[model samples]
Target: MTIDSVRGAPEPELVQLLTPEGERVEHPDYPLDVTAEELRALYRDLVVVRRIDLEAVALTRQGELGIWASLLGQEAAQIGSGRALGEHDMVFPTYREHGVAWCRQVEPLNLLGLFRGVNHGGWDPAEHGFHLYTIVIGSQTLHATGYAMGMQRDGVLGTDRAGATIAYFGDGATSQGDVNEAFVFASVFNAPIVFFCQNNQWAISEPLERQTRIPLYKRAQGYGFPGVRVDGNDVLACLAVTRKALKDAREGQGPTLVEAFTYRMGAHTTTDDPTRYRLKAEEESWKLKDPIERVKAYLVRNQLADTSFLDEVDAEAKQVATALRKACLDLPDPRPLAMFEHVYAEPHPLMTEEQERFAAYLASFEEASA
Candidate 1:
C-alpha cells in the first residue's frame, strides 16, 4: 500500500461493528465473538473507571488531588483496547491513559504520584505488565517500537504466541516527530505493535483539523499498515477492531493503527479551562452519545442486564469513587530516598552525584537553621 499524503482519500476499509444507539451491527471484515460475561466485564470496567475518573476530577477541584486528566468519554476505547491484549502482551501508556492503566490492574489512585508532584512514575511496569505512563507526548511510541522490534528479534512474533505490544497516545501526539518516527520504525521492521490513537477530537484546544487533513487511521497506509476506525463510544466495536489488530500483529502480519473516534467530555487537565476554547454545544452532542449509556441501553434492550443490575452498578460506582477518594488522601508521599530509583537500568552516575549533593544541601540547611 502506497502512503497517501492527503486525508480521507484512502479507501474506507475500516471496520465498525456497533452503533451508538445500543444496537448490534456488523462489518464484513471484523467480526465480534464475545460472550455475555465478557460484555458484562466490559461494562463493569467502563463504570468503575469512569467513577474513579470522576472522583479524581472532583478531588482536584476540592483540593484532595493536585491535578487529574479525566477519561470521561474515552473509557470504552481504552478498556476495549486493553481487553484485546492477551495476558502475555505488554502495554505502554501516556499520562492520560488512566483507563488503560486501570484495565491493566494498576489501581486508579496510583496515578496521583506524578500529578501530586511527588514522583516520576506511579507504579513499576513489570508488576502490571505495563510501562510507566510517559508524560512526554508520543515518547511511548518509540518504546513500544523498540519493544516490538525486540520481540521480533527474539522470534516471538514468528510463532503464534498471542503476545504483542500496544502503545496508547492521543490526537495531539500524532503530530509529534516521535510518533511518525515510530511509524517509520514499525513499518520498516514489521514490528508487532499497535498504535492505538484515541482521537477524542481535541488536542487540548486544537481541533482534529489542526493535526491532519485526513483521518488518522487512513494515514497508516503510508507506513505500510492497515488502519481502522471504531465507534469508540461503542465498547463492542472497539473490542472487535482492536482484537483483530493485535491478532494480525502477533501473527507476524506487522503493525496496525486503530483510531478510536471518541470525545473528551472534560477539560484537557485539571489546570485547563476547556470552556475557553470549545463550544458547550459540542460537549452536549457527545454526551448524548455517551459510551456507558449506550452500553447500558444495549444490555437492557437485550435483557443481558436488568434495572437491578444497573442499580447495583450505580451503587458500586459510588463505592469505587469513595474508595479512590480515600486512597488518594491516604497515599503517603514518596520517601526522600525513593526518588533515586528507576531513572535507568544501571546505576546512573549523574543521578547518584545529584542525590548526594541534595542530601548534603539538606543537611547543611538543618545545621544552619538549627
Candidate 2:
C-alpha cells in the first residue's frame, strides 16, 4: 500500500463500530452497548484530551517544555482503551500515552513538569494504578508482564477482585528485543496482561511497511496467544475490544495482543518534522478519519447530543486548555540540589558528597554576587 492509501480501506479483520462518515456499524465478535450519556462522556474525553495535547504542543513551541510527544490523531485509541480498564486494572505506558494519563486522572501539569524537567513524574504510581512513563522503548511491556505474574501469584485471578494489566506501546516498539521478550514471558506464564499496540503507521520517520512484513496483530499467533486488529479511529470498537480483553485476562485466559491500526497526523514529536519524511497528501487523507470528528458526527446525526451540548463540550475543552496553560506556567522549578534526591532508595555517601559539593558551588556563586 502506498502512503496515500494507508487510510483508504479497513481490512476485513479490522473491527470498526463507527464508520468515518458518522454511520454506526455492528461487529458480532465485539459487541458494544453504550448509553447516550456514555457517548457524550466519550465525546467530552476526546475533545478534552485533544485540547490538552494542543496546549502542550503550543507550550513546547513557546519554550515552556523541553519537548513534547503529541497524541494528535490517536485520541480515540487511548481514550477508548483507557476508559475500558476496570477500576483496579493497571497500566504501563510509554511517554506518549497522554490521553491514557488523562483518563487515569493524572494532573496534566504533572505531565508538563516531566517535560519541563522539574520532578520525575510527580504523581504516585500506586495511587493512580498507572505506572510512570517509560522513556526506553518497549521496556514497559516486560514490567507489565511481571506485574501481571505477581497478580497471578497473589491468587486474584478468576476472582471478583481480579485485575489485569495493560501495556501501551507504539508500532516501532514491536521490533525491540524487550517487546519480543515480553511476549514470550507473558505467553509462557499465562500472564493476565493486554499488550496494546497503537500502530500509528509512522514510527518516527520510518513508515509502517518498514516495521513489519505482516499485520502487527498476526505476531500474537506466533507467540501462542490471540491477536486482533481494530479500527484505531473507532472509539466504540476500541472500548469493546479492550474491555473484553481485560475481562478475559482477569479470568486467566492469558495475554491478548490488540493492534489499534491508526495514523499519526502530526510530527513524531515537537523536535522532529514529518514533512522531511512523509507527504502532506498522506496526512490529508487521514484527516478524513479524524477520531474526534467521527464521534461528533455520530452524536449530531443521532441527536444523542444537541448543538447546545456540543457547544458546551467545546467550551469545557477550552476551559481545560486554559487551566492547563496556567498550571504549566505556575509550576515551580526544582532546586539545583533536588536532583540528588530520588536517585536511589537509600542515601549513599557518593550522593551526599555530590550534594554538598553542589551546595558549595551554588554558595560560591552567591558569594561572588555579594
Question: Which number leads on TM-score?
Answer: 2
- Give residue 319's error in model 2 in angstroms: 0.6
- Steric clashes per prediction: 2, 0
- Tens digits of lDDT, candidate 2, 46-165: 999999999999999999999999999999999999999888799999999999998899998899999999989989888898999899999999999999999999999988889999
What is the C-alpha local distance difference test score of candidate 1?
A: 0.85
Each model's C-alpha lDDT?
0.85, 0.93
Weakest 10 consecutive residues of candidate 1 by summed lDDT: 1-10
RMSD of 2: 2.4
Q: Per-residue lDDT for 307-344 in model 1, tens only?
A: 88888888998998887778777777777767777778
Regions of model 1 farther than 4 Å from truth: 1-14, 118-122, 158-162, 341-349
